[model samples]
Target: MNETIGAAAAGPSDIAAAAGRLTRAAASGVPCAPVRDLIGRDDLAAAYAVQAALTATRLAAGARITGRKIGLTSEAVQRQLGVDQPDFGVLFEDMAYADGAVIPAGRVLQPRAEAEIAFVLGSDLADGPLDARQVRDAVEYGVAALEICGSRIAGWDISFGDTVADNASAGAYVLGTERRTLEEFEPVDVVMSMSIGGQEVSTGTGAACLGDPIEAVVWLARTARDLGEPLRAGQVVLSGALGPMRPVTAGDTVTATLSGLGTVTAGFTEGAAS
Candidate 1:
């Protein structure tokens, strides 16, 4: 009944306008219809192009690209989304927080939390096919991370194209202080447990993220390269969720602890913008 980004359909040529509408909704903390519905195109390539256009708009508005995030890497999450491969999104400098920071609930729409393994790159990864070992070798260290995801699409009803165009639904992220070098970490076997209000809510292992988190990084590297945007040195890469994502409410405290990688926490407060 309402005309929102996802409520109405647009032609394939409406990519730019669709991106603009989504960007405005995100900035205003409002949810809209899925871009896929608005654009009338489910093409992943076009979706990514829209994401790039949105990122450019942000950059033009004084935002800087700090890193990237990999999403939908878990088999369970993939199965839920009906997608067989992972997707990537750009991370902005303003979207980062240190462990134990208090986050305003009004900043995001329908936020959810997921535990992650964050890789800080030591050297630039060129665009090309890479293996897990190559991905690991470029890492400066691995730290426990929490990806706070929020959807700009109304009701979180989205297709793969919708999320891709929504910048992988990335909201904010917090990284632990205890960073371990590759020699000190075995990512594939690390265990992660998340808790809210002092009660355990979700648990998972590194293997749950594309068999090994490094593989996600590798996939991202290749994919970004193909998209003509290679991941760079000094950039932090969120290697997907280690477990199912849990909803966040105002006044809730969420904590994620990763074996050998340490812990990260986020506090949500009331009075969100929307």
Candidate 2:
């Protein structure tokens, strides 16, 4: 969370090339080679630059930014990526699915599922200390969520910069219907159990998410502000995964239960994306 925000050392051409590679991958449903060669493996700023360029393209195509998603909250994942802090990605309105919905398998290449806590903000976070208290106060409500993660990079082999440039490897998400206020339960204390095809595949607690999901938001709010894109009112934030992520494929059903929050399910179907 102590990471700084600044312009990437890579020039505009490299940034554009990285973005173009990811854009084609998403558009054609074919993963591309890692973009680290263009943006540099350890350059967070440069990677984010590629993400920003893609975001601009999406906005130009009339895509709406519904929220933001945090990634690499798991210490184990951090170790795999060789990073100490989490990264974030934009969440588009089109990426959202209701609870118990059937998701198309073709929507994402090499999809994976993980449980998470989703917060809908009631107030703007542009100006504040962005502490845990402020994050809790800003929330309109909380819900159980399933993050369907994917990578535009081939073989899912990526560096910190590659994943960041690919929008934290975001694909889609499902939000549960049940909602609760912060007063109803503690986010850091929530227990999670996730199952696929009637078998439990992942388990963890709220503490798994950057110590607490609120702490993740605090990190995001500050980072987003520093990057000139502060969070706004009514934005949905997927704090991060509460447990290990399991690979999901066609016809797989994923159910996740979050204590004090509620249960959410996502059914995957084979065929073209809808």
Candidate 3:
């Protein structure tokens, strides 16, 4: 598995070293290549392995695993990335901010926003080949979530591998006002709508997420287990998006209205204060 990643000029060590550099940049507000150089490798498995390692380092360093995020799920985003599928990543607890929390957007490199449905896990999920039933059983609540997508990519040329390693471009997330119980809302039939700056931008139904979000959660958990980072209890998983991702800038306010759950809003740091 690693030999494939070694095909890159940087090799495994170089790729691993780049991870440290990435952490430093993210912490110190400096900038560097965002796993794109590693993505140039011809082997898909290798690139993904590098991402797993990068994510593992954060976990080992005490980063709390909160939930999972699935990107490129929308057909439009799939076309933009030149892929017909979605990529996934883990969201850390510290990365979650309550709605209305002032996000110092300056720290982000080209931050954007996307509203998504967030699933709160009630129990640890370590099952292999996990099914939608398991996901449903493990989830205790659902809420509207807003994912703030920040990327180190100067241009929008990032590939699936690059996005994957960058944690699906996840920087921060916002939880909405209400928590809906599974019994209250049949997640499979819930509708969702997203608006940016008061203008509707993305919309779809809960069914858009691979029939039901629980299915996406099942896939994420089983897949993460295959990668060696099984889902943990209390993690907030942002299922796939209901629609395409829109570009957001400073001062932009965004909200996602989830039928069963409610709404969550996050405002980008205003220019002078951004």
In order, how many clashes per candidate?
A: 5, 0, 3
Between prediction 1 and prediction 2, which has the larger TM-score?
A: 2
Clashes of 3: 3
lDDT of 3 at 73: 63
* Residue-level lDDT for 171 in candidate 1: 92
lDDT of 1: 0.86
Q: On lDDT, who's better, 1 or 3? A: 1
Instruction: Estimate, for each residue in 69-130, the C-alpha lDDT of model 1 and write its tens digit.
Output: 99888877677777788888999998998899999997778999999999999988884446
lDDT measured at residue 103 in model 3 versus the true structure, 0 to 100: 72
Query: Candidate 2 vs candidate 3: which has greater lDDT?
Result: 2
Runs in model 1 deviating more than 4 A are 1-12, 127-129
> What is candidate 2's lDDT per residue for 161-219, written digit by digit as tens?
99999999999999999999999989999999999999999999999999999999999
True-structure lDDT of candidate 2:
0.94
Select the stronger candidate by TM-score from 2 and 3: 2
> For every model shown, what is its TM-score relative to the native structure?
0.93, 0.99, 0.85
Worst 10 residues of 2 by lDDT: 1-10
What is the C-alpha local distance difference test score of each model?
A: 0.86, 0.94, 0.72
Query: Which structure is stronger by TM-score: 1 or 3?
Result: 1
Candidate 2 lDDT score at position 188: 96
Distance from true location, Cα of 204 in model 1, Å: 0.3
Q: Across residues 1-274, which tens digit of lDDT does each residue of candidate 3 receive? A: 0111134444676567656656665666655665656545234454565666767888899877777887766666667777655678777777778987767677466677776788888987896447767778888888888887777555544777677666677777889879887888887787878888899998888777776777777767776776667788888888877766678776778888888787888887753222
